[model samples]
Target chain A: MATQDKSSIFADIDEGEVDQEDENVDRWRRNLRLWRETLAKQWRMLTDDLMVRLAMITIAFFMIVAVFAPFIAPRGPLTRQYEGDAGIIIADWVEPSFLSSESEYLLGTTAEGFDIFSQLVYGSRAALLVGLVAAVFTAGIGTLVGLTAGYYGGKIDDTLMRIVDFLYGMPLLPTVIILVALMGPSLWNILFAIIVLQWRSTARVIRSQALSLRERPFVKAAQVAGASDWHIISRHLAPNVLPLSFLYGAFAIAWAILAEAGVSFIGLGDPNTVSWGTMLQSSRAYSALDFGAWWWFIPPGICIGLVVISGFLIGRGYEEITNPELR
Target chain B: MSDTGAPDVSDENPLLRVEGLQKHFQINEGLISSLLRATMGKEADYVHAVDGVSFELERGETLGLAGESGCGKTTTGMSLVKLHEPTDGRIEFRGMDLTESDDEELDEFRQNAQMIFQDPFESLNPRMTVYDTLAEPLRIHDIENETARIRRALEFAELQPPDHYFDQYPHELSGGQRQRVAIARALVLDPDFIVADEPVSMLDVSLRAGVLSLMERMTEEFNLSVVYISHDLSLLRHMCDRLAIMYMGEIVEKGATEDIIENPQHPYTRSLINAVPVPDPDVGRERVELAGEVGDAIDVPSGCRFHGRCSEYIGDICETDSPSLEQKAEFDDDREVSCHLYDSCGKQS
Candidate 1:
């Protein structure tokens, strides 16, 4: 079944050449199958718990609402139901249409004659946007720093870890508030603030995971195989420590959303944006709590609570899978 | 020290040659602690893991490095593959000095020399499939025909119909099967030399013979010279062509497998050979109990490293001078021992 060609001891004598096209197609199909199975398993684990399932559902609902805000929201977020003296609908202090037939606003109107329904629907976009985008950047930066620090260790670990320690020394909310104030209360500035602090937790956790991972015999085996430092970090250590990065990534989303909401509650949110934080700021200015207008403040607050809770639940699901002992 | 048992010194080149190889690990690697030591004016300490070790291997020959745990046998094996860069001395593989080798040469060295570690459970990455594990070195060295090569290597290692295991993870295989996969990974590149540090020590007794026979067959088939590091003297006698017994990071005694096992020269070697269970109650072997426990590698005994535990403590010189490994016994010209017991003890008198 074999030829005497010393060069091709592994080669099949009967098979003249390996068709690169066939090999690529075969590998592609295999990888696709593997991906499908892995995704199915992860989905099962994530949805196994009733709490986690509800959390997933909440995230899904927010995602849908955010994507379809234009159609789902009854009016433009900035549209005032009553403009100047036209005021045909008596939009000022309008109660929810469901609560009182006299009001036309679905989730009621703010004291400023704005439809709180439209603002609430449109606000989901900002929360999801800042949370997901900031989390991605945070996870990427944290994973890079952690993998490099832990794999190369010694001096590099000391430098990066000390930087993380210094960052940890800063209080999260105050630092974010000062940053947002300096950058002038924009959504992007808020996201930047959240990302700056949020990456540290991921970096610290991933660095510990990477520290233990690099010491595993597999890493030394890779070294013995003559793998470069970069190759070992990327191919071997990164994949093993990836679950920790992702776990922190899920938590970063929650942290970003909460940080943004906290800043917005304290009136540092962007004046021009339609985020839940801005909604809360606008409602709070009119003393909605004093006026018994729970609709004005409660929906955005509930939305923030649901998103953060679900983010944590989703992160816990990932942790259970990555660390079975946590299950 | 005289070199560990290699045939014919005049020969131009053997597969691998190691001389005065040493590897020391600093006790305090942390910046703050080391700085604290510097401030205190205390010299930094190190664990002399592999100290002044020398050995050579011919093509297709197996040299078993035998010693108790913590005797630096494993460290010497690691140093041989350049896994632990020598703190000093030379490791020349086919006349190429590995320690000073540039990236290209180091890369070449990596391809030509490989290692099979002690634990199969720990060595294979838990996440990687068998295919990925075997394909790692090939991908690193840019070797192509991965599937075919992996299949052949697996089959050669006797994981018959190797495709059966291509998709499985390490946990899926039995201990013996995992060791075979480890061996397959090492041999995938067709390396000229390999260091197997107790490859089967972690396997069950039933599975050990199969892996060992497979390795013995692979050595012949691939013409690969191997340095096996293990404390099991009987296993060494069964598997090795020649044997070197290390004590406190130095080669204490070395010779052909039969010479070292049949007539061990040094007190340490004798104690090691005596400890092996004979498996026969009818023929009771003499037991020789030595002195204290193995000394700390950090503060190795000044004179002969094994002098504390050596029962044949002949003279005062045993505690004062380090004896060079030489052909100390006349009857067996090949065997070497490092002990003042064989010396005239002129200074003590």
Candidate 2:
């Protein structure tokens, strides 16, 4: 009997190991199938609406442009030169040939004879980076804090909400000024300022949504299933909260972009890097409106308008996907 | 009454023994001054949610715990599964003290004791397909050979043609089908005990009996000891082998089903039994209209919890000393009643 028991124990151990291997395989297979199904569903979503497809394509086009601007633009963005004949020029302004110069740049010349097209192309990179990165940082922090506050509603919730309220009361423009002054003006610093101020709204929205989701019976069922607190948050709570987060994140991206433009248009952004906002700043400083230099200012202004509009359209597309009720 | 002191004929061994269970929620003073009182030494009072409730369930027996809303019936059921930790007392399952178990042991105990929630519509994960929902417990408990286990569970729950339903999302299924899937999920782990918390209450009246029968069949087939909780007393009388009646967080009466229904001793029990709607059109029974609303469970009555609504209150004695459960002389061994009338009168002559 003792020998038989030992043999059975060994057999059980072997079976346990086999079972573990089988489960791993099964989980991988299941996850693969689930991914395929999700892809199929998203494909259906993409094909169903013209607006969503258009929005996606437009965003994609801008991203490609932003990535390959260095290769695409003809002249170096910062290099300046005196156009027409320098010898014939008076008071260091343009020469007689400037008005009728057939050998002009693609987007014409700026006040300093820099290529406007090159500046616009290169500025897209900074604007897009700051907007996307800032939105991601703010959304990630907001989601974590909101999920914690909403899932475990006690002193933690109260303290976090109080902090949100306190932050909400601060004047936006003045706060940005203070932050920029303290941290010094750079692309990364501007992104940081926008995220620090903007995360409160996302946190508030996420907390409200989470407050409703936490009371859901599935959450309690997950608790009774012997799931730990972390498992409950990640598995049960996070999936439901993600759609809302994505919706808010799209809007946050647009907001961050606008805020970055506002700061840089007022001369707080990096003076060296020619962002669209900085281009606008230089155009306004030189009074391109009074001088009628459409090539210098109009193109950069149009670029800013197109970027913000694309961000808004993308936000609307995401809103429709996350909330079918809205559709 | 049997000589072995076992209420049910199936087995003499008790699978679960709950003694003096209590759950009190401390209600903060008020909205305005609670913030101020937090800093001061003043303490918040409590709502006595599940005060001094006790019962025992033998192996393979269905014990129905019936009471109105806010009477702590659900709280009692949750306490057994350790969903809400009991404030005081002991719950012994399979001779192991549940309150004393560590986190690991408690987890093992949770695997042994499962729960079926009330709302079939909201209880399930709308995002998950029926297969994943059913397979979740098996995965969590580390059951071997997933395909076979899932097939067997689906078959056991009578989800016929498993292939047709396995890939279907929860929203596509009917309420009854969703509930069947929920039951399949609960049973997949092969648990020894299950807490059915108003499992059939949310279903249509026509569908209620079918769900109840399925539960009954599963209880016998799996040899599971169940604590079936509901507010419907007639259903309890039909489904359970033993019955425990709770009033304002206290079990006022408990006995075999026949004894509690046919010969209820406590006034609260009598009121509950009388409230059960009779099916026969000609049989006109006097509905015992309970006076006033149920008193605050937070501030329970001074003496007996049910004294505010009890019809047979015996003056100051009923108001002064709280009554403890005593065995009725007529059905001495089987039935217990908590009333001052029984305390002084000793036995009904």
Candidate 3:
């Protein structure tokens, strides 16, 4: 009887091992197939939408312009130089006689002898950098705070939300003005200001999302699975809020760009840098309206408009991808 | 009895033991009103969710905890697993005091003690496919070669032909399939114990029996100790080795399943048993209609917690001094009751 019992136990153990091996092989195959399915779905979405394709092209153009500004611009953006017999590059482009009797700059030039086209192209680098970086900074901070506060409600949530409310209620324009005054006007400083002001709204949205998500059974499952607070926030909670983050990030970039331009137009921008807002400020300083030099302001204004429009399109595309119910 | 019967492990050898567990939620009235009420000395009111509950489970045994809604059955389960911080209690799992364990220790304890939630539909993450969901616990517990373990666990839960299910999302699967995935996820870590919180209650009646039988099989195959919580006493009796009946956050009666079902001493237990729908059409068992709704746990009755609703109340003593759970005189070995009627009945004899 003892020998038979031992033999049966060994047989059971052997059977379990066989079952386990078979299961492992099956699981690997299933994971591969699911991943392929998800990838296929995303690929279909990418190819199907015209608006999404347009937004992608515009983003690609902006990125290329930003990356290859030196090669694309006619002259160094910051250098003040003149062609022979021309007052400066700007005069050469705008005044027909400055470069040659028969020559005309296609896009004209500023009164300071700088090429308007070149400045418009090069200015994109700074605007794109500030917009992308500042939006990322704002979104990252907001997502973390929102995720933490939302996932772990009670005192932490109350305190963080109160801070968000206080910030949201503050006069945003005046706060930016004061921030510029304290930090001094520079690209990085302006970026900092935009992020500080912008993070609150994202935090509020994320917090509300987190509040709803924290009570979800998946979150409870994560908790029971011995997941740490950080693990639960990152693995289960963060992914759900990511689509919202992407949408908010794009919108925030557009807002930041507009705000930067507004501050520069109001004479709060760096005196050394040549941003679209600074171009407007310089044009205003030269009394371009009085002199009728349309070359100075129109190109920069158009660039700003185009960038903001592109940002909105990208944001809309992200909204479509994130919200399947809407789709 | 002498202290040598089971080596007196009641004080030392319990695998999981809970004592005097309570959870109270403070009601926050509107701001101005609450402030005024605070000054008037009626500052706060509480919902005594789990009020002074206690129970024990030995290693390798399934303890079925059953009670009606709002009776703190789920709360008791949650407290044992530390899902909610107990208002007051000592929970010992494998002789380690859970209440005093620090965060690191609690984390370690959690890896050993997992919970399977009720709702199969909502419990799993919608974003993750079956593979990632199963892989999550294994990754969290640092289980090695997770792919192999996940497959093994899935098979253990009887989700056979594991390849077909490996890629399927919860939405794609049927209700039974999703529950199997839930159980597989819980079992991935090779946990020593599990808290199944009404695991099969939400499934169809036909599907419920399958899930219940699967759990029993897993319990034996894995040699796992479990706390099977539910409102279905009949299912509990079928699946559990021991049974504890909770009423308003306290266990009114507890014993081996056979003993408790055959001869329930507490009025509350008898009522619950009567309420269990008789499956046979011909056997018309009299349904004991309980008096009043279940009492408020926050401000429970004066003496006995069940006195207000108990049908077999033994006079004013039932209203003034709460009866303590003691071994019944008739059953020398395995049964306990906390009711004045039992005590008075004994005295009369």
Ranking by TM-score: 1, 2, 3
Question: DockQ of each candidate's interface versus the true one?
Answer: 0.42, 0.28, 0.33
Deviation from native of the Cα of residue B107 in model 1, angstroms: 1.9
User: Per-residue lDDT of B207-259 in model 2, one digit per residue for the tens?
Assistant: 87778888888887777889989988888888899999988898888889888
State the C-alpha lDDT per candidate: 0.84, 0.77, 0.79
- Could you tell which candidate, 1 or 3, scores higher by DockQ? 1
Interface RMSD of each: 8.8, 10.5, 9.3
Query: lDDT for model 1, on a 0 to 1 scale?
Result: 0.84
Q: What local lDDT score does residue B347 receive in model 2, on the 0 to 100 scale?
A: 44
lDDT of 2 by residue, A265-318 (tens): 888988778788888887787777787776677787787777777777767776
Summarize candidate 3's per-residue lDDT along B1-349 as a digit string, tens digits: 1223323343466778787778887876677988898789884788888877777787678999999999888878887778888888788876668889876667667776888889999899877888889998877776555666666778777788776676677899888889999998888766668999999888998898888888988788766789999999888988899998888888888889988887787899999998888778999876778989989866777889889888877799989998877675666647778876754335210
Off by over 4 Å in 1: A1-29, A84-92, B1-11, B29-32, B344-349
Q: For candidate 2, what is the DockQ? A: 0.28
- Kindly list the per-residue Cα lDDT of model 1 for residues B1-349, writing each as its tens digit: 1133222331457778888999999886677988898899998888999899887888779999998888899889988887787999898876668877787767777887889999999999887889889988988887656777788899898998988897788988988998999999998987778999998899999999999999898887776789998998888998899999998889998889998898887888888888888878997778987667789988878888877777878777888888987765454356667777784223310
Error of 2 at A210 (Å): 2.5
- B11: Cα error in model 2, Å: 11
Between prediction 1 and prediction 2, which has the larger DockQ? 1
lDDT (tens digit, per residue) of candidate 3 on A1-327: 011212221233434544444434455576577668876886577546787677667777978988898888877655654564644424322643344455355455666766666777778877888789977988899999999899888889889988998899876667887899799999888888888889999999999999999888788888887888999998899978987887789888788888888888888988777788888887787778787777678878988888888788777776777776767
Residue pairs of candidate 3 with colliding backbone atoms: A90-A113, A90-A114
The candidate that wins on lDDT is 1
* Reference contact recovery of candidate 3: 0.46
